[model samples]
Target: MNTTDALEAFALTWTGDLTYDVAPSLSCHEVDTLATLLRALGYTAAADAWITKHSRNDDEGDAHYVTPAAALREQLADASDRTPWVELREEEPDAFAAGHMVLHAGGRNRFAITEQCDRPSDDPDRT
Candidate 1:
C-alpha cells in the first residue's frame, strides 16, 4: 500500500488515551493509542482487548499488525524536527518541564506513530 494507505491503516487502530486521578493532587496521565502503536512496533504491551487467532499473545500485538512505511516515518520525523511536539511549553508548561527530551532524540519507529527526535549533537559540559 501507499504511504497514505499505511498511515490511514495505522490511524484506524489508534487507541487514544486513558485518564484517571489516582492521587488527590496528582493524576497519572497515559495515552493508550500511542501505546497500541508502541506495542506493535515491539515497544509497549498491547491492550488486553487484542485477542486474535494469529497474535502469539494479546500483549504482543493488536488485533491486526501494521507494517510501518519508511517514507511516512521519514516525513513525520522531518516535520517533528521542524516543530517538535516536545515543545508545547507555554500551553503545556507542566509537560514541557517533565523533560525526558533525550529519549525522543533516538528511536526506531518504521511506522509514523513515533518519530526519532532530531536533537543536535550534545557537548556534555555546558556549565
Candidate 2:
C-alpha cells in the first residue's frame, strides 16, 4: 500500500486517548496496525524491532502476552529525533489545538494518527 493508504489504515484503527487525564496510550491492536504498516512500507526490520520491544508477559508465557505501546505513543506524538528511523509531519488542527502526525519511513508514508493532545485544554502544556 502507498503512504496515503497506510495512513488511512492507521487512522481507521486508531484507539485515540485511553486515559482522560494522564498521557495518551495506544492499544495493542493499534500498535500492531502500525507494525503492519511498517512492513508494508518496506520497514520490516523496524517493524520487527518495534514488536519485539513492546511485547511482554508476566508469567513469560503466551497466555498473558501483551504489547504496551504507551511510552512510544508520546515519543511518536512528539516526533522525537531520538529514533532516526521515522520522520514526522505534524499538522496542528485548524480549530482546536488538537493535532495529527504523519510518520514517514523507508521512503513511505507509513503511519498517521490524531495526536493525544489534539484538543484545546486548560493544561498549559496542552494548549
Instruction: Tell me, by TM-score, which candidate is best.
Output: 2
Task: Output the lDDT of residue 28, model 2.
Answer: 54
Model 1: lDDT of residue 70? 34
Q: What TM-score quantifies how close candidate 1 is to the native fold?
A: 0.16
Q: Per-residue lDDT for 40-115 in model 2, tens only?
A: 7666655554544444322235322443333345457445465588775664344224355666665544566754
lDDT of 1 by residue, 5-115 (tens): 775566455422221121112211223344455466553323322311112222314433332333344334445556654321112233333222222333332111333
Q: After superposition, how far is residue 50 of candidate 1 from its true place, in Å?
A: 41
Each prediction's TM-score versus the true structure? 0.16, 0.28
The local distance difference test score of model 1 is 0.34
When summed lDDT is taken over every stretch of 10 residues in candidate 1, the lowest stretch is 19-28
After aligning candidate 1 to the native by TM-score, how far in Å is the CA of 112 from where it should be? Answer: 7.3
